[model samples]
Target chain A: MAAAASSSDWPGRYHHIDQILDKPGPRTDPGFLAGDGVKDFLRGQAKILVIGAGGLGCEILANLALTGFKDIHVIDMDTIDISNLNRQFLFRQKDVGKPKATVAAEFIMKRVPGVTVTPYFGKIQDKDEEYYMQFNLVICGLDSVEARRWINATLVNMVDPEVPESLKPLIDGGTEGFKGQARVILPGITSCYECSLDMLNKQTQFPICTIANTPRLPEHCIEWASVLEWPRVFADKKLDNDDPDDIDWLYKTALNRAREFKIEGVTWSLTQGVVKNIIPAIASTNAIIAAACCNEAFKIATSSAAFLNNYFMLIGTDGVYSYTFEHEKRQECPVCGGEALDLAISPELTLEQLIETLTERQDIQIKKPSLSTPTKQLYLQAPPQLEQATRPNLEKKVSELVPPSGEVTVTASTLPFSLSLRIAYTS
Target chain B: MKKNEDAAAKKKPKTSAAQIRVQKDLTELDLPATMKTNFPDPADLLNFTLTITPDEGMYKGGAFTFSFAINTNYPHDPPKVKCTQTIYHPNVDLEGNVCLNILREDWKPVLNLNSVMVGLQYLFLEPNPDDPLNKEAALEMTKNRDQFLNNVKSTMRGGYFKSVQYDNVLAR
Candidate 1:
């Protein structure tokens, strides 16, 4: 097909996209200019990064390539699994165990002909700001909340008020079963993923006693097998969640427990789902969400149409319901909001207790947090020597450690930006 | 053989985050004079037993023992606390389940081992009848305080109350 196509055929291939760029409409972005420069910028110079290569990622990559995005880079650290073939359309049976990013990139570049897709088979964290800054925009098809928060914080922190190019617009898409959402985040301008942490459902947990002694539900029995029985039976060996043998053992154990309790409804699939915390994914849902994300990306890239205000939610489970609304930015958001977040805490709270509160807080959930003030380093979670030296600070009262100014800075392993907290001592 | 044994020993799991936090909490524990903590396995800080002997409550002269089991997600999650012995109390059921607010809905990561110890102590000091695990005890305490006290005294002294046997938790 590449040999049959001539250079003259390239312009005709993108004729539909050229029509939008060549003629401006009433609903176009305010800064959009009607000319060939928009198309030239999109096809010639624009560099976009697509994070993740599963489910929605394959669709997003295809949509971008078909919409005339030429230079694209994708990063994914996951390897191809047999289960991913149902929704991730880029790989075949022979491609199992290969990196998703590399396979997806190769597939896209081969089919699209004119587009170039570079793949990095590594974590998004491995790339520094220098790599991320080179891209004009980013599209995330990530399933992990932590990865989304990391990228959102990174883009938000990269924005320099003086440099316009440093502000990378992040378009994020997520799908769970028949429900999904796509949102446009102009870094330092719109509601980031961190600002909407409460929108996610809290993970459900079974009580220890119910699972240990009186399990009434199938899930309870499964938890008993995984949480209590697994450790006791295999004390030295860690249960590999991905290994089928381990899952089979857990399933057998849970089935026995359920039989003893006279409870029904324990199946192999349910056991795997419960153990792996699987969310049902449909290819149609991924396509719908990815198309929404790519539509926003095209608008942001070509200025052919007005981009989504902020958020678009689609619910296909209940007769194809959809809604678009602006998700407001939180002023106290730790990533992109004000100078400092006001935390009301008791004066007697210890530094360790404060770190724990930060870690468990719903809105600002940070893992492995380290704290410091202007005058001294209160505590550090890393570099064994420093952690050992600052270990005693964890026991001291917050009032004793904090200065009169009531300002403390916190850094976490999961976050790309430092959080400034202003302590408001509660009586 | 010595090198291989050393390697195997090193391969043993390092202290988890939950264990580290529990150790920190145990180290800084400021238990009152009436309370005592005993770790059956000193190396395993994740599981321990706490004995509370209130000095000046209605339940004075009674020693209540509770087993604390901290899981791997600690601080993020509250410890599993259960009464070691079933007794006649409003918040403690016959199956040894405790219904402390901090252990359930009101559990925040800011709460420490010390806070839980204090909360458990407060439970003995003031057994809240409003929220009860044992409804009969709650009803008895609410309807007739004198009879409730008698039932508690009898139950604490290793007697039968309402056809259920009770262990003698009285201080020796």
Candidate 2:
């Protein structure tokens, strides 16, 4: 494998580093660094999209040029921080704060002139139809589960609609400390991401301890099943009416906790700090995941390779690497089963289906009548306080109105009142 | 309406953390004379224009323009790029989509603007259609080599391109 990469020769051209090194007069030519075969491979001009420009993306991208993948597109919505320098080898101390996609593209172009790089320097959600169709393959290096699921659903669904027979493969890879897992979705030939999610959901049903071998929370403790009642509590006392007692309790229990929860979950926790916590080891694990994803992608693009239609996992924690072949034609699986051929998911129908299921659920019903509406919404024009009470209810209410989840927040002050009247209709 | 208003109300600071980094990248950029960079809007450092005049190969004498849009997320992400100019190339789509790896899927934080510019230049010198932005272009180049060459020549010569009017400048 190492033999494939030829030694880099200084082609005697002015490089990016040369500018920084230039003392005064003439610019120093650092010479070119493309392997002899690099030019040949890049000559074909394959357009590839790397979803995340994180640590894994950096290593994989560097290797891509050496391997001859020239026309590359990168999509990442993140900034180089002081912390990322450890293993995100593509960046330097000077690159801190620059856009990763722009900087990465620039870095590759300076070293190798025989390649074209474009950067979709925004969140993947910002990508439109033109953005999605431009690239041939999408190499997912994103760390967020939401991002991974979005990519899988969007790209795979888009490909299926436009070219069902040639549904594009989505290679989602990630690392958790010492462990990395990559799943390849060949669309028709194998289980798609949704199918994989179903499998995970099934695993959860078999008792968490059985699957993960970790102890579950004690049954006695309240695990925040619902905050729905809190909205009514706040409304019943009218905290906004400046009742000192009502305000104190609200702040002590609900308001303070909610505020803290938002900050903890969104600002600090949402960041891919899990990967950052382990430093080079986690980053290296991420890089391995990326390589595996790309390897699987290459096979899908060119022709069938050994690891086609399989889920490969590398556990650095246990120093083990193994793959589990997912049955391509599983009658038991709902996503890729025989029935799915006719009931294939479409992007247009996906949102509608999701909304239908969300609203149809018996759990989420807003109270009717003007008196029952949350006083804040009635006065300040906000979502009812009840809407913010529980996670599932909140998600359902918001997702019913809007298509996407994980971004929007619903609080108790946003929920509606008149529960008795609303319950009468349901009962 | 509230969401839209909230989004609109949020003032994007004149010098965002990402923009500051881009400025640094630009100052340190060792751009060749053949390649020049321009900011369409001085206020928006995130989005800029790149003009490339190839000194050699099939795209010689032809000028190409590309648009670069940098998200607020800097150095840790790749910038969005599109071909602003319509050109006859297998890797570039009629809609101004480019077949660049770093921009798409192979980008790393370690790579910078300098690397991307060089890659764009490479596309001009040697257009790769294998992972083509335009599948038709790739198919023609791979399966019908002669027709592909003719199409490229005609487009370069400022002739009618598939019934669509295009301004063509001769190659050096």
Candidate 3:
């Protein structure tokens, strides 16, 4: 442990962290005990699980390591791309095409000695509850909404009132084009990611007729080329948005279509951006958001100071504005509320229509959902034979399939936990 | 369990919200005698056809057939309407795509199949020269009305215009 090492060994190495952990001031947490043992615990015991190795992940990993967190694990399913070199400072030209988690782990551990970062080059879903239960806390820098929801549900489900250690603190950070947010979610104690699901912006979809016929904008032309022309031209193959050749073909096709319509502004970068749905990322935003997340993690782990209430949002586009507020836990939150969400529908609505409503609802977006009542299964999207058998039930009226209690359980491929819904038939 | 599943699969299919709404729309339809509808498959009300024969217009004697496919997202999303036969009109393209505002941008959940039928019929009665799927036809209509009417008559007779052959939609 670093406690046994004499302070003379490393003159200024532990000086900064020592000053904070060695003494308590006016704003220190009431539970804080100033001593060398706090530093030792941070250096030897605290285990962290970081959920991405992209822009914010790289910055968070570096900040966590420098903040005296010794044991760290990171999970990233993406490989390093040349485009990521602009903001993900941990990766270089030589590191392109390598697993992001592995390269990031190697870079951080090499830069800072005595810090061990274990990299998982796979999806976070691949790891089970037991794997997550071993960690002291988890920090997320993931950009995918589905992944964030899955992890949030998993962590919330792992909590047991009887066991204290099962309650893992989750620090999440995200950044996009000079705007970012950092929040702390204490599994069962505070508001979770699911509680604020409506905060996310809905995906923009161009109308099919607009893209197919009257395209007034460059994005509309790009959508036409990618959505309509690509499928018609390449019947057997799918467009790989990452490949330069595919993007070039789309750009040329869009450019030609734009010229036919006498429209302008069809560029290669715009084609790539439209196809990949790339958000503009800035390095400074990532660093700031990551540092905020790490600061929350540090305070939560050591209790040297009061942690952030729940959410902190920063908008740097107009002269650096920021705000911190407490996001209340929703009573109808499917994950932490422990109450079935109430949904009112017409009694004449068929099972298929009900399923469509569930899938389309922004707050309860579950892809390929299987539903079941207490006594009978309404529909199942899996296992060929079962799916075929339940397929007929899709056409049946929900009033006929569900019991008088109107309680149903929905499970989906995108979620880690089943959703409980209380259906009310509106006459 | 396997036998039970097979038996369940063989049972009668139930109606969906889209089917219910479509049935309601058909029952309440107030179409003129010049317009008619047909169901290719009686069991499937979601997919049907509408034929409109304008009474007094440039396309008076011509019968235009449009196929409508309504999915489960009906009312929220408009039905997929397409001309069954390619015709030369300002609003209808060479590929039979229609350019009706109600069918695309102005669609609302309150709008029903009857509304769409009326919109389609109105296109034949008065083809708007502003929003055109066929720019050449729209331009002809705007620049020289007589020449546009000639092109429409010739195209309806299964003749060629600008090296493009159109389907014979004229009534027998």
List fnat per candidate, in order: 0.00, 0.00, 0.02
lDDT of candidate 2 over A290-407, digit per residue (tens): 7777766654443323454577767676656666666354432222332211112233333324335433546643222111111111111111222222123322232232222111
TM-score of each: 0.66, 0.40, 0.64
Judged by DockQ relative to the true structure, which candidate is superior, 1 or 2? 1
Residue-pair clash count for candidate 1: 0
- What is the DockQ (computed on Cα atoms) for candidate 1? 0.06
**Which of the two candidates, 2 or 3, achieves a greater DockQ against the reference?**
3
What does the lDDT read for residue A90 in candidate 1? 92
Decide which is better by TM-score, 1 or 2.
1
Worst 10 residues of 1 chain B by lDDT: B9-18
lDDT pick, better of 2 and 3: 3
> Residue by residue across A1-427, what tens digits does model 3's lDDT show?
5653333236679788888899998889888878866776777788999999999999999999988898899999999999999989999999999999999999998998877899999999788777898999999998887688778877886775667998999999998889999999999789998778756653466655567668999999998899767866886798998799999999999999999998899999999999998888999999999999999999988889999999999999999999999999976455676434667788899999999998898886679877765445577664333456678988989988764335676766454445667666777
Candidate 1, TM-score vs. the true structure?
Answer: 0.66
Ranking by TM-score: 1, 3, 2
Put the candidates in lDDT order, highest first.
3, 1, 2
| Alpha-carbon deviation at A198 in model 3, angstroms | 2.1
